[model samples]
Target: MAPTTPRPPTMRDVARTAGVSTATVSRYVNGLQRFTEATEARLREAIDQLGFTVDPVARSMITGRTHTVAVVILDIRNPHFTGIVKGANRKAQQLGYNLLFVDTGERQSAEAGMLRELSRRVDGLIVSSRMPDADLSTLRDLDKPVVFFGRASQVGVHSVSADGRSAAAMLGRHLIDLGHRRIAYLGYGAARWDAERKAGLTDALREAGLEPMFFSADSPTLEAGEKSVGEVLMGSARPDAVVCYNDMLALGFMKQAQAAGVRVPEQVSVAGFDDIPFARFSTPTLTTVDMQSEAMGELALERLIELIDGTLDASEEMLKPRLVLRQSTAAKVRT
Candidate 1:
């Protein structure tokens, strides 16, 4: 005959051991009522002795809250997104909540499906979406509190994001101060921040009585940056400086340019956004903008929780970006 499994300790066992009624024990366990010190002590002792643990499923059924929050990001492989997750997860654990993460692989359809499914299981959501405004507007019907990350807020949704335009303008002014004229922008067309950053750079250049040259990368990856070296660095009227969409592209561009016997910050200066960890450790230490990725994540989670609790109305929070100076950029030498 198969061995019988021992039954797990239940509230009845705890109540019996503590010499209390089952309803009293339930109220104590759920923090729904206060008891005398002696009674509370006895209940605690009984719980400890019996190794009693609250059943999450049962508690959730009673409270209508799963104590779980979901975070949806575009790409898990990117350190920026991972940093956001790390911040949110840390805060969730501290608040006695659980976190569920989903990587949409930069696909709008996948993002939508995951949001719909997760809304049913989690208390709230945090999304870093790349979808158009029309598609994102429909998320209000999910009936769950949502906080947008790294994107603009919709009509009724809260959002947290770094000021990309101001940050890019700061970078542009820095390069201009370093005497870098004939600047080119290497960017991915699909990024939502692309237009903002580009406009900021253009604003700074126009202030200096100059216009920027534009180049496109198929994607915002290291390989795309490396591949653009020929057209951006070696072609006729080669730019004296190039501002990439992010750190990965800048690192790749620097690597390829150096391999082709070009000097960084000497022949052509390079800069990037999103001051990722690898940016400071790379050869010539990349100059970039610090978007406060982790802090944004933490704030987004907090805002979502407040929304869930009905303590906060839909709003937008914009984080300030700082410019990080490094050896990758310098005063342009006159030919």
Candidate 2:
């Protein structure tokens, strides 16, 4: 024969021990109402003596809120996303809420499905998506309050993002000042931020009476950057400087270029966006833009909570980007 299991203390047990009504106990436990100093002390003592704990599931059922938020990102492996998640998690924990994350693998199809499933389980959402503007507009219709992390929409949703266009323009002007005439941009075509970054680079080059060259990478990764070396660095119209979409690509391009007997900065300068952790430690170091990813993440979570509480209107917040100079870029040498 097995011994019977003991039952956990309930709100009724706490109420009886404190000599208070169950309704009063419920109000106190759920923070729905306040009690006098003497009454509160008795309740606290009773709860301690009875070893009573609030059941989160039962509380949520009664309050109609789980006190949980979900974050949807494109790629978990990218340090940019990692920084965002870290910030959101910290903010969530501080506010006594839980965080749920879903990686959509940079696929738009998967993103939609994941959002639908997550909306039912969480009180709000923070999304960093790569879907089209039309698809993004539909996010406003989701059952939960939504805050976009890296992209903005016209459909009246809250969003937080770094100023990528301005940052890319700053990088472009830096290369131009270095006397690099044939400057080219290498980027992933599928990225939602690619168009703005390209436009920023184009704007800077046009101001200097020069046309910007464009190149595409299958994805924003080291391998894609390495593979483009032959076509971008060894072609007839080899660029004197290259601005990659992210640090991963810049480092990869530098590695393969050096392996092929080409010198970095000396022959071809390189720069990238997103000053990831490894950027400064790479060979020759890397010149990149700091997107303030962690701060944006924290801001996104704050905005989402405000939206959930009906305290904020639909608006977008754009953080400024800063350029970090390093040894990877230098003035072009006259032939």
Candidate 3:
């Protein structure tokens, strides 16, 4: 046969090339049709050669599945939340799901509505922050799967979190190991997680027959860290070391110490949790515990997928944290 100039392809063209019906080609493109490997490969190749394109909106109408998962996050500006988004987005793509990110911007009512609205369209959901007042009830009423990360839910809810308890323990033990007899924990002191972390710190202190000095902060802001640490340092006796709730707070405490003309390690030692990217770059760096943000996201996404597929039971899964020692921590020195 003489060489023939191939015509640009359409659904019919793809079907003819693949030796399948036009309807078959259409269904395959819309993901409404299942196919054998050979048939799928042939259709795929034909479409590629023809530069075939389908309107995703139309495809969604036909298939009834957008292949999208909505990820509702609180404050994308937070480094930790950003890390979870990164991991969840990558996994969503790997699993053939599109990401529809909704930032709550840290508003309770806004998050609640966005969550409910997103839940209606997405095949599943992954929420990064604590569910707002009605958010949990909404998730409970949702027909699709939902998984929470770093934030916990009700008794029956699914959550993936780093071992908050262990994180405190590691930091505490590290300080005790350095012969710091008196340590303090400073953070948003009343939160459930904060309490758990404090327990771990006290546990570590008890193991070494030491006592921990605690100064409760209203929040984890750097200002709070600075003020709290200042009070501790100004007390009758200064703690040999202090463990902060997170890197941000730790950095603040470190700054306060510097301004107060205290010699670090020689006068005071500081440890922090949540080894955010900035933790390693901080001045004098920081001795912190890594919450394994990416790993937490991965596990949360996996758990969401499982809940969607009905492959695994919804449950709380905790990943352990690791201690990161840097220039900021050293053996205690009596002033």
lDDT score for candidate 2 against the true structure? 0.89
Residue 222 alpha-carbon offset, candidate 1, angstroms: 1.1
Q: Ten consecutive residues with minimal summed lDDT in candidate 3? A: 128-137
Each prediction's TM-score against the native? Answer: 0.89, 0.90, 0.87
- What is candidate 2's TM-score against the reference? 0.90
Top-scoring candidate (lDDT): 2
| lDDT (Cα, tens digit) per residue for candidate 1, span 1-335 | 99999898999999999999999988887656899999999999999999999998888886688889999988887788888999899888777789999988888766676788889999999988887877777578789999986554556888899998998899899999999989999988788888889999999999999999999998778898899899898888999899999888899999999999999989989999988899989999999999998888888888888988789988778999999999999999997
- Model 3, range 106-187, lDDT digits (tens) per residue? 5564665666778878778887654433446666676778887645456356878888888899888888888788788886
Give the number of the best model, judged by TM-score: 2
- In model 1, what lDDT does residue 234 have? 83
Give the per-residue lDDT digits (tens) of candidate 2, residues 105-186.
Answer: 8787666777888899999999988878878766887867999865565787788899989999999999999999999999
TM-score, structure 3 vs. true: 0.87
Candidate 3 lDDT (Cα, 0 to 1): 0.78
Better of 1 and 2 by TM-score: 2
Alpha carbon lDDT at 298, candidate 1:
87
